[model samples]
Target: MAGQRRILVIGATGTAGRQVVAQSLKAGAEVRAAARDPGTAGLPDGAEVVRVDLADPDGLRAPLDGVEAVFLLWPFATAEGMPAILDAVAARARRVVYLSSAAVRDHERRIERMIERSGLEWTFLRPHAFAANALRWAGRIRAEAVVREPYGAAAMPPLHERDLAAVAVRALTGDGHDGATYELTGPETLTQAEQATVIGEVIGRPVRWEEISPQAARRRMLDRGWPPEAVDGVLRAQAEMVTEPAAATPTVEEVTGAPARTFRAWVTDHADRFRAP
Candidate 1:
């Protein structure tokens, strides 16, 4: 933490990346926020926002110049241009902290192989369901005091975006985290219904959860303009969760030296969004 290292953050405008940029700046790191359009990135003050399209990383070579560490968040479903991007980053950067998913756990070797071949110091963050997923129900709850979704009994230990950001900052700036893969989650498990209840409590209203068939939910998502594959993926994931035990881990606390935020706390913090006008 002596000299200011230029840290390149992909998806800097996203929920987690925004926090990463802010936390990195707070930690005295020089942040270079990379997005498709720098003008629209709206990053925190003091960040040098740059345009870098992951779909076509050919012209993105300039952004990696003088960059020491990279915060890579794959915004695409497939790893198409990742090799080129990683090659560019590895050519200049000494370390990379990748924002991965819990799905990576079941496919670790594949991802690890790709990262290891990059020849850069790497840290992988495999975060479970994000508490921000509640935002999907925000519209329904605000309008009708009801959240309709499939799998009310599906349990998830949703990790807060802030906690994930803290861990990413540690990995990006601190030592002893290279080659580590951390599974981050909230401190407690809550079903979809329980999460709705928490939101209701925070908003001081009597919100209710209404379960729908998976097919119905799929149709609803498709009608809302979600890609067909994405709709199917969500329904399949939820169906699997209904019968499987929720995945929970303490890597967030272990890495950041603080406990993970709770679901109720997250809802409480965002209560205004769910409140009825």
Candidate 2:
């Protein structure tokens, strides 16, 4: 941690990974943005752009060479190829800060076991619903002023991507974060309907929420080219959380020393995406 560290960021073009790259660069870490196609990753200035295909482990070795730390994002649904991937990273990197999900807490020991077996310094960030999830309703809000979805009353404490990235940067470059699992969430819990209403208020529109059946919602997602498995996962997760007590956490503030941005703030930042042409 004393000398200049080289950090590799996988999925560098993604919503969260982009922020990770930006924050890491701002922190003065020598950053490498890794993606399948380096040509279009659009990495921040001063960061080296490299091509690393996750599907082909042989090709990944070169890009990871001499890297001190890695920001691993599991784009695959299941951790099927994780063993080989973690082994590869552990071979070169001293630390790994993984972008994980809150669902991992339900089976905490299993995930921790896997990371521990990797024999590398590790930090797991288990974040709840993302503020960017609201972007899913952008098309509807732009057209009809009504966001239709199932489980309208299901509440989630949505953490902003920037907040998550800030924590990742700290864990990657700082000490005392190894082997830590941080559960990140927004400052407050709001239902899906309430989130839509907040977006409307931020955009200065009268956007309303229309509840639909889970089956219908699944069909709609499928029609829009979402895979069946993903559709099922979304509906099942929403239905299970509908009447359950929402889980809120202060991990963002604890890790970043700043309050997590509200959903309203996220809306204001991305209001242009929902603006009428």
**Cα lDDT of model 1 by residue, 1-277, tens digit:** 6326789998899999999999999989999999887887888999999888887776668888888889988877776667887788888888999888887733344555688888899999888899999998998899999999999988899888999999999999888998899989999988889999999988889889998998888888889999998788777777788889477798988999999999998888788889878
Give me the overall lDDT of model 2: 0.85
List, in order, the clash count of every candidate structure.
0, 0
Candidate 1 lDDT at 275 equals 87
Model 1 has an lDDT value of 0.86
Q: Where does candidate 2 have its weakest 10-residue lDDT segment?
A: 104-113
Candidate 2 lDDT at 53 equals: 82
For model 1 the TM-score comes to 0.95
Cα shift from native, residue 123, model 1 (Å): 0.6
Q: Check candidate 2 and list the clashing pairs.
A: none
lDDT of each: 0.86, 0.85
